[model samples]
Target: MSLRLHRIQRFVLSVLLFSSLVCVSCKSSEKITREVDPTVEAYSIDEDKAIDRLSEAIQHKTVSLEDTTEIVYDQYDDFIAFLEKRYPHLHQKVEKQRIGKYSVLYKWEGNESNLKPAMLIGHYDVVPVSSGSDTLWTYSPYKGAVDEGFVWGRGTLDDKSGIMSIMEAGEYLAEQNFNPDRTIYVALHHDEEVGGVRGAQRIAEHLQDKGVELAYLVDEGLPIAEEIIENVEVPLAMIGIASKGSVNIELAYNQDGGHSSMPPRSSVIGTLSNAVNRIERKPMKASYRGLIVETFDPLIPYMTYTQRLAFNNTWLFRRIIKNKLSNNPATNAALRTTAAKTIFEAGFKENVLPVEGRVIINFRIHPNDTVEDVVEYVRDRIRNDRINIQVLDRARNSSPVSSTKAMPYKMLKRTIEESFGEVLVSPSLFIAASDARHFHDLTSNIYRFRPIRARHEDRSRIHGIDERISTENYIEMIRFQIRLIENGAAEL
Candidate 1:
């Protein structure tokens, strides 16, 4: 009886100690957010002038069509010319060059040459409005109309606001003669909606050829998302430390053609469907470890008490945490490599089976997984010798994850803190590819962030009808840009 009591006491003590440890660990590492930056004055913009400039800027239909030849370069030229006229200070103050014909690169030489340059990149080319969706727009997609306290049009949020705000900030700085201690480069790409092959890629190559390494590169990516997570309503200023890689895999299963009535025991269509189902039902293993730690750590204190417990002691509650996170597509995408069956082609008609059946599966490779690993997963999932799998030519692995501890990141973070006060800032996985990916070879300190407040419903507006940005949000974007430029100045 004495021995049993001792054992029971030891067990109870162990549970108490563990619980204490977890409770202590659940405490926040840093304050949920710093007090609003009282020292730095908000960079003011002439609201009417800024809005008019953006409105006119959006009127140019510089759409990046899937077909390269279908893209109108004349419009791109006009857009470039418009910038030259509207922001004459930017053009006159910086050394400007045209990269890849329409894409423009500007170099604002700093007083200090020893420091590495900082770059701001964004695309002016917007995605084409889906056919027949134009009528859904209260204002025309290309009209760039300012009405009802919103800038209603395509590209208003996707990126034109980002580009215009950047230029406007730089122009304002130049007008005020605020010379910095580091060189600043801003590149506006002509094509980013498709793949950035002809625009951002060329600009990256141009910088590489010049042997120019950057302190950091900022491009249009994750934003200040509101209510991205359930029950967490605080806006998250997510800086994308890395973007997921993308690959399109074409799976072909072909057999002898036959009549629909007398199909073989295993037809090509059946085999292909099975392959698709296998990939879908069993996806790549989900992981909550690694970079995701920094992604959510800052937001921990803002989460519910139970939520904090699950995230705080991931070792004991990892499975429960993963289960909770996996329920949402956005959170799940951050947790693992996603496989989507984008295209499927089988029979030509109902009467007969086609000889060839092709299914295209697009995988957004996670930072933990490589392109090679993704291809292997596809092969293993299918496991059918008869099926032919080919990774498309454009398939590439994920970008190198940038350091959260690096000075450039610290600078970016400081900028966000000082500019958008009291906002919860955190690093996150950018599930979609951005123009920043093109500059991976240039530096490992690349950060993809678009300084705009967004919500779950506002996501589709980027490439959908009736896209718009609130008037106040547009003005705030310019202020963020101004602070980013000042904060990134050379201090080393």
Candidate 2:
């Protein structure tokens, strides 16, 4: 009986040891965030004057229309003139050139000519309010009303705020005689809303032709997400290290037309519907590993106990985590390539069966996948010799992931800490496309971050109606830009 009791004790001890080990592993995670002293001093600006500048800029109807013929070129010109009138110091300090149709590039020469330059990118163009949606806004969409402690308008958030902030910072720096060891280039695209084909692309080519390789480039993108992730209430400063590639695949089916009474079993509409259904049903595989792991590592420390355990012990809970993440549209997009069927057209009349049906599927390619991979994905999924598949124009491969260890990334991280004080910083995959995609070959250290403090509901306001930026957030953006410019143009 004593021996039996001894055996029970041994078994109990073993079970306890195993449980303790499991607990330890569940809490283990490599914290990659390094606490560092800020490199730039806190700078103050005239808040009212700064807000006025952005508000006035937003008042301009520099809307980007799909058909360039529909655009009012005068508004674009007025915007350029407004910059000259407002930022006299910047105009005097830098050499400005017009590229593409309306894009502007400013070159601020540095003391050290040998050092590679840093580029600050932004787009002045804003998306147009949908027809009959104007009444939905509390303030006029184009009025640039400074009410409710926010700059109420179309461009305030989706990026006149970015343009105005950079210009404000650059003008202030130039006025302060803050000469840098490296050159600074400010490239503002006019048509980023449509695709930046004319604006950013032209500037990139012009820079490439001049053999202008940059040390780094910063553009507008992911922001300081406040309460975006559940259970992690702390704000996350997510820098877009890379943007997903975008391609619109057109799938068309052509067949003989027939009357509605004698519908064929395999009509063009049915064939096209089947193809789209198949593509929608089988989305590209979700990738919870690699960069995504790196993206969420910094936030793991801020998660609740259960959340932390699940994230930390992904080996045992990967499927559970994946299911949870996949359930949400936003998180799901981050983990995988997304195929959205944006346009589907079949019969034009009620009684006539359409001879042709066309479906356009726009896929945002994952960082791991390529444009070719997506095309092959669609082709294989459709598996129909009769259907025609063609890739539309403006198709681009995903930007190569920039290194988090790079000096530019680190400097930007330091700048964020200096500007926002306490915040979680991480490099994330930008699910949406941005003007930064145009500069992939120009620099390896391209980071897309706008530094705007955003909540979950604030997202729809970007291109949607009632777009606005809080007065406080706008001021912080200016300060952030100032620090970013000074830090970026400083010595390595």
Candidate 3:
């Protein structure tokens, strides 16, 4: 009987020991995860000062255009002087260079050799403000006033924010006396709103000539948004990994001129219009099997169980995913290449039948696709040999995929993760063009990320009236930029 009791006691002791071990293991894991700095605390940004600076920037009215006939009120010179005044500390420390009449470049020399440098790019130029719409604005377009959490004006969101953030960070680093290992270049182009012939492209050419192969280039593209992820509303910081290539094709057809009463079987206007209709009907197929879809896979773990299951079932999810993306204009843009018909010309006068008519198409090509493929696809769709297709301009596809593995991207993600707290960081393809294209050959990895939270109303103001960024987001943006430069510089 005593022996039997000993056996029972030994078995109970064994079970208790196993249970204790399991509890300890789980506690250790939970503790380690809690220690990891996934979410950065939110700090109050200096909203008033940020708005004042943004407002002052908008007041300059630096309209970029191809017409070299300068506007009498053109304020490029004044803008340069403003930068010199605002960032006096930066001016004293960093090496600054002025390219042409307006473009600016700054270098913070590092300890390493000058083989590969990481470049942070932004432009100061803004599109001309549309006239005769004073009442459309809640505040004057140039007023830069902070009302209801936003700093309103032109260039507030487009790019001046990028320039401000970089300078703010540089100034802070100088104060901290922090030095990076690799050389860093801050290139600001003067003509991004217009084509970048004299501004960014020329800058890239000069850098290439100087044998400066860039480690990576960071530019402007996507923004951070709160409470919206796959319709679930999580904070998301979208970094643009690549921009689609652009091609302009002009289609023209000729018909013999004649009196309006006596017309040919098919007029030039009719044929041109028919070609456009056909091209539109047979739109480019949207495909999601690429780097873009892959980037979002990491976020699946953070989603709800239903969402996780939906994400996991690739076979069941493909059709639903495509449909969901097609439903939203913004999501559609991020997933596919887009074709827009910008200009069309047909008749010289109403009374006469024109001899020639032309239509121009602008295509934003996806990274997996090429300009040749786009043109060929359009040519095949139109199928009318009488229509002449001529290429106007083509900005060739960039080489790098803007890897998340790169030091700058990792630093950006880490900084954002700390600052925004709960936001998920993901990369996508940016539809519009930016100055980053010029640095494709020089920089191996390039991305576009502005760390600010924006909404539908904020996005509408981007080339429209009362364009503004949140005063709070603006200050945090500056802090994030300072952190990125400081963090990225350390690895160099």
Candidate 4:
């Protein structure tokens, strides 16, 4: 009996030891912290004047339309004239050239001519307010109203702020007689809202023809995301190292038109609806690879205990995590190639069945997938020979992933750290298309980030109503741009 008791005790001790080991292993490893320097001088600008300038920029109705011919050229011309008049110093210092008909490129010559230059790009074009939604706006979309400590207007958020901030930084620096070690090019595209086919594409081609090698290209993308990850409420400054590709697939089916009273079996509308349902039910596969993994790896330590446990042991919890992420629309977009049936057409009259049914599905391709891969997957999923599939408009594959080890990335990260103290920084995949796509051939190093403090509430405000930026956030953007410019010129 004593021998039996001893064996039981040994077994209990072994269990206790194993449990303790598991607990220790599951805890977060080591915390990494970045030191904020007290000696680093903070850049300041005229807050009132800056706000006024951004307000004025918003007043110009430089809206980009899907149909290029519908764009108001006079508005763009007026906007350009406004910039020239307002930033007299910048206009005099930088050699400015208009690319295509509306886009403008400004080159600031650095003292060190041999070094490859860095480029800062943003589009002046803003998406037009949806028709019949004008009554919903608190302020007129084009009025550029400054009230309640926010600049309210159409371009206030989805990127006139970026353009104004960069220009503000340059104008301020130029006035200070500050010269950089590397040249800087500012490309302001007017057609980024409509695919940038005319604006950014032309600028990139012109630069390529001139044999200008860029050290890095910075464009508008991921902002300083607040409360991005659940349970980790700390703001994350996400730098987009790559952007997702976009493709529109058209699924069309034609059938003989007949009276609604004697509807034939498997009508075109019915067939098309079934195909869409099938595609939606079985979406593109989600994987924990590429940017999704890269983004979460560094953030694991900052996550909650349960989240840390799951993320730390991706091998066991990957399926669970993927499912959880896939359930949420925002996280799902980050994980897989998302498909949305944007446009659907069928019968025009109530009593008549239409002969043709057309559905336009847009897919934002993940970096792991290609345009062809997306198309093939849709074709195979539908499995209907009668339903014809065709690529619509322009289709672009994902941009090549930029290296995190490059100096430009490091410089950009460091500048962010210095500007916004103690914020977590990580590389993220941009799920939307940007003008940076045009610059992929010009340089391997392209970083997409705009230093705006964005919260979940700001998401809808971007292209939706009441688009505005807080006065303080606007100042932060200017300071970030200033630091980025200075960092680009600093010694490696």
Candidate 5:
């Protein structure tokens, strides 16, 4: 009988141990789910009127030129007046102030004075359509043609849509007399394409002088990326929590001039060319760290079985994962700093051996590295005492990485889920710079998101030929802005 009791006890203990192991495995791989609002209503707009307003705004030709003198100030004035005429209610209801000659700031007061305000920012500047690419476009670059369900133009996708959606949301709220418990600030910067020094920077200083602390700031950035990952087919909404830095380094080699017929064994051009080739061949080391790792963590659960196995066991598959990510240009950029040689100057005539040769390389720095780090890496790779390096412009460091656990982030996530059902949301790093980078001093909660559906095919259209946005997508953008404003300002 004692032997029988021992057998039964052993069976029970084995079962309990098996159950505990299963529970632990389940807990380790659990997927996070958010509670979403099922009946969140979409905001309505006058479709024809909205499209007409956008078309008119695009026709104004408020293009940002590298040389400020080239910009037509009259066009900017006309665009501002057009905004006032189109959205009279917003102008009358909100206190408007012009900063830095052209940037517009609108303040909407709330009942609660103690609550910090929320900010919505967008830039109106559009990159110039390259001189020779006009023939490639299906529609006129500045005509703002609304055809076959797309509003086609230079500013359509780059950003005029972003600012217009914000204005439409504000006009809707103001017309309905919707009062909030927190203040709201709308900043429309005019010079973002050219670095935003005069527009966004001045706005930040003006707000700082007034002693204002923001609850959150939202700017134009990552869209609802469709089929972004290799094995993940679902649409993913990427919110940019930080941005990379930028630096321009000029590498120059100077030697005594000589006739091409009597060139030295290594001329200035030859040495500089060799340095460029070496730097390109030996790039900065790419690693899976910082925001890139954070971005991939939540995606594991949704990946295909093979992908899931590979991602879940990163210790064993680290090399495989890095190799796969490095093969693609987009993913490769997410992995490390990238170098591009943009400008190169040598002898004006082929028969002359120039005394000086220069190459300007631009680097988009990863958050893990700094300007000094990039400079050191380049110098080490070149290893040529003859090459003199000069930093041509002010180098910017990586912006502070905002926390994913903050209340503003939570609110932003919930609003996105509520607006677009059953989509995966992830915190990502913005590869490009935006106006929000200037507001790092005011708040730690800066989010970069634009609620437009973007796919791989639409990649080249941005700042390229055939730039456009679908009319339906524009409506969705308006709905998203309205939801964000309503939910983001609600009392916690």
Candidate 6:
């Protein structure tokens, strides 16, 4: 009887042990499921450090081919060396190549195969500081001063912010021992200010030689605007679906040479002036169409219910919407291709009644439109066949719109959502050009967006005086980049 009792006790103990083990295992599984992954957080960046780095970068004065002696080459070289020293891990790990005299390229290897890599691009060069405006600047152009949470200098807003964000993100990821599933490239071009012929063009050619087409390329163009549309100031993260083709139209009228005292019924200047006025009077059709419509669709969700409903009723609401948004130049550029008379060449001497006079009209052609189309459009507007039309220089129109529905776009959207909470994500048409066009031949998915936000006045500072970006924005830009890299890899 005692032996039987002992067996029962041992059996009960074993059952209890088994139950405890099962409970512990279930608890461990639940914990694993509950824990969230690390993601980009807003306003959590090290502001001081970011400001320090930005300040140093600005002080370098890496202005593009614009100095008096044109001795900016040494400054460019020193800047490259500075990057090498700043990012030792990136230099040691990634394969490095110099395309143009100052174009810097670094490639980071990843895990998975078959997927084309992503290219993150930024220009290291800046426009020259204005010569006459010594007092116009709050801080010297190359001073790199940090005051009141802002880093003041040239290139801060134009592109050095982009370079800083890329480099910092790379360094952070390298430190974390993070290896992505696909290759990543970083390109810093020096001649973007002068038109990327020597900088971005060279990098594109080198990649083409390797038979490499990017899955998508991201470059610095437009950023998040606060009030892109009426009552819709969500982060307008423009993945440049396309950039407008450019055509330079010169209007000229020939008249018999005469003194100002003996002018004809209609002089060359008078005719040309009338034609220019006529062109201005009849503006490009500002209808919401093609890529411009595509750009507006994503923001509809973020709009208020009334605005959302209005946005949905495309036929009834587009004209009303366009009129409401047309008040601002920046916003107007988003809606349609723009034409401006940027330059004019007429009399040799100020007082002379020259026989020949010309006015140059600059047109940013919409993607669906071509140089020929723009020329025709100009001709039709002028109503005067006498005006000489010429194509000074043109680039093949931008790539066809990439699939915003694709995984890469979704990943970018997710990254933006994670990085800048509650900010709206949308595609936009870029009036300005970027290097993204070069990759379109290889891959159809090219996006142009920089993770930064600027107010209305700050936008002008891009190529203008006192160009700057906030330290907080700079750090967030880096964090967003890290998020992008991680999310991009996860798909593979």
User: TM-score: which candidate is best?
Assistant: 4
lDDT of 5 by residue, 158-251 (tens): 7999999889888887887877789999999999999899999999999999999999999998888876777466678889999889999999
Q: Roughly what TM-score does model 3 have, to 2 decimal places? A: 0.85
Estimated TM-score per prediction?
0.91, 0.90, 0.85, 0.92, 0.91, 0.87
Cα lDDT tens digits for candidate 2, 1-492: 867755764565465457656665543343435443344334658889999988899899999999999999999999999999999998999999999869999999999988999999999999999999999999999889998899999999888999899999988888998887899999989999998989999999999999999999999988888766675677788988988888999999899998999988889888999998898788888878987788788788776555676688776567667878888777788898899999999999999999998999999988778889998988899999899999999788788889999999999988998887657888999988888888878889999897899888988898998899999988888888888887888887
lDDT of model 6 at residue 31? Answer: 11
Q: Please provide, for model 3 over 6-47, each residue's C-alpha lDDT reduced to its tens digit, 9 standing for 90 to 100.
A: 576456546544665665332211111222142222323455
If both were scored by TM-score, which would come out higher, candidate 3 or candidate 6? Answer: 6
Write down the RMSD of all candidates, one decimal each: 5.0, 6.2, 11.5, 6.0, 8.4, 17.6
lDDT of 4 at 296: 70
Poorest 10 consecutive residues by lDDT, candidate 1:
24-33
lDDT of 1 by residue, 390-413 (tens): 998788888888888999888888
Which runs in model 5 stand beyond 4 Å of their true positions?
A: 1-39
Alpha-carbon shift of residue 320 in model 2 (angstroms): 1.7
Q: Which of the two, 4 or 5, has more TM-score?
A: 4
Give a tens-digit lDDT track for model 6, residues 1-492.
867755764565465456656654322111112111254653245557667877888878887764436755788888888888887776777899898877889898777767678878888888887788747889988899887777888888888988888887787778777887888888988888777887888888888889987877778877877757655656566666566666677777776786777666877777888888988887676767666777777677666544565567665556656776666788677666678898877788756688888898887776667777777777887787776766676535544777778777777777777776656667777778766665566677777787778668777787787777777788778888878877775543
Clashing pairs in 1: none
Misplaced by over 4 Å in model 3 are 1-47, 71-74, 111-116, 131-135, 226-230, 262-265, 299-309
What's the lDDT of the predicted structure labeled candidate 6?
0.74
For model 2 the TM-score comes to: 0.90
In the range 1-492, model 4's lDDT, one tens digit per residue, is 867755764565465456656765544444546654442344557889999999999999998998877889999999999999999888888999999899999999888988899999999999999999978999999888999989999988889999999999998888888888899999999999988989999999999999999999999988888767765666788899998888999999998998999998879888999999999999998998767887777677777566776677676567768987888776788899999899999989999999998999999999889999998899999999999999998888888999999989999999888877768788999888889999988899999997888887888898999999998889878888888898897655
